[model samples]
Target: MAGDAEGFTDFATSCSGRLFRTAWLLTGDWHLAEDLVQETLGKVYRAWTKRSRPDDPAAYARTTLVRTFVSHRRRRGSAERPTDSVPDTPGGETDVALRVTLLGALGRLDAKDRAVLVLRYWEDRSVEETAAELGLSAGAVRSRSFRALDRLRAVLGTDADDPTRSGVAR
Candidate 1:
């Protein structure tokens, strides 16, 4: 039990920056990223006091962050209207090619699909871990993952058979 406090300290110190960056990427807003990180850490802190392993704190945290972001989107999505116009870019100077491509592809995904893809690719979690985190069966995770990847490829205009984008090697 005493180790839990030390675990909290270590986990917070080690993973905070990465978590913040991920949150920023996920939310696309720096202020919201701070809120997400703070809220996620609070949930982590509560879980840490009762959790079984210090080494697995990050696993718990990542799951919580995904869950939190999904819940946030659901709560806020109801008030949002559909957009018909293409989004305006502020500067034509900087080449935002990769960012535009990735964000465009990601925008086409449902919240759950986005979470699944992000966890699978960005966080580099295995199918089993992703399934466990999302409370899904392994088969469901596998099916959804390929479907999500296919959608990403279609949006990115990449051949589905391409090895690099196939996500098998990388």
Candidate 2:
């Protein structure tokens, strides 16, 4: 129906930016993040057309995006390979450097660990909500979140001596 299409379009327009941010965090590449958002929107659109509308379209889209990222990582023969040197960028700000460092550390984490951290910390979702999103138990989500933070801290080399040094705010 025309009304349904308009509704879906409006929803997509409003949520695309947030979805792209989550996708970018999940995938450390801009192009890949765009593709991921497109794929997620396609999935959501299909579901929207075929079934009754979901109670929470935003949450549905977020779950789909995260699941899609994890599923892609599970697949074999991914074409992406890390390059020895990054392409030159103009910014030299300290905040930019710290953000890049944090993203690099996140990229090094396992997909599930990255998902847990992004959902729990970056998105500021509760443990129960994260558990529901990631299809993990509450205890598992808590455990993974704790361990992932430790791994991230190790990667970022942020010790107790200088908590303020890490760009992440309390």
Candidate 3:
């Protein structure tokens, strides 16, 4: 029991930042991202205390986080509430603008599409890995990734042939 607690403590400390980043990308809200991470960590801890620990705790945590985000979106009352004003985020002008624009466009995506894009592009996961994590087939991952990119382009109003125009590098 003591060993499990110590191991989980170390694991959570090391991976929390990465988990928070993925959560933020998935949810596009700072507070919600924090809550998602907390919930994910709780689930991971519960699993850690079980008789059989996951072969890859980090991957398990990441999968748990993504699944939690997707399921939360499916809940009826989990819809986003609009704020009258945007909170200020500190960053350089161009970087901040591009980040905000991209996040906005991503936020407009369906939950599964957003999950596909984030896992495939932002996290740089392979199609097979993403499919496994999302419980989707490789073909479904590929199809969703392609269509999600198109949807992102449409939302950003950028030419499909010139993704750089949206300030995203290839």
TM of each candidate vs. truth? 0.73, 0.84, 0.87
RMSD for each model, in Å, please? Answer: 5.0, 3.2, 2.8
lDDT of 1 at 124: 82
Each candidate: what lDDT?
A: 0.71, 0.80, 0.83
Clashing pairs in 1: none
The residue pairs in collision within model 3 are none
Model 1 CA lDDT for position 40: 93
Model 1 whole-model lDDT (C-alpha atoms)? 0.71
Residue 156, candidate 3: Cα error in Å is 1.1
Clashes of each: 0, 0, 0
Given candidate 3, what's the lDDT at residue 42?
97
The most accurate candidate by TM-score is: 3
Predicted candidate 2 versus true structure: per-residue lDDT over 27-111, tens digit per residue: 7877778999999999999888865767888999999999999998887366765332333335665566556667778788889
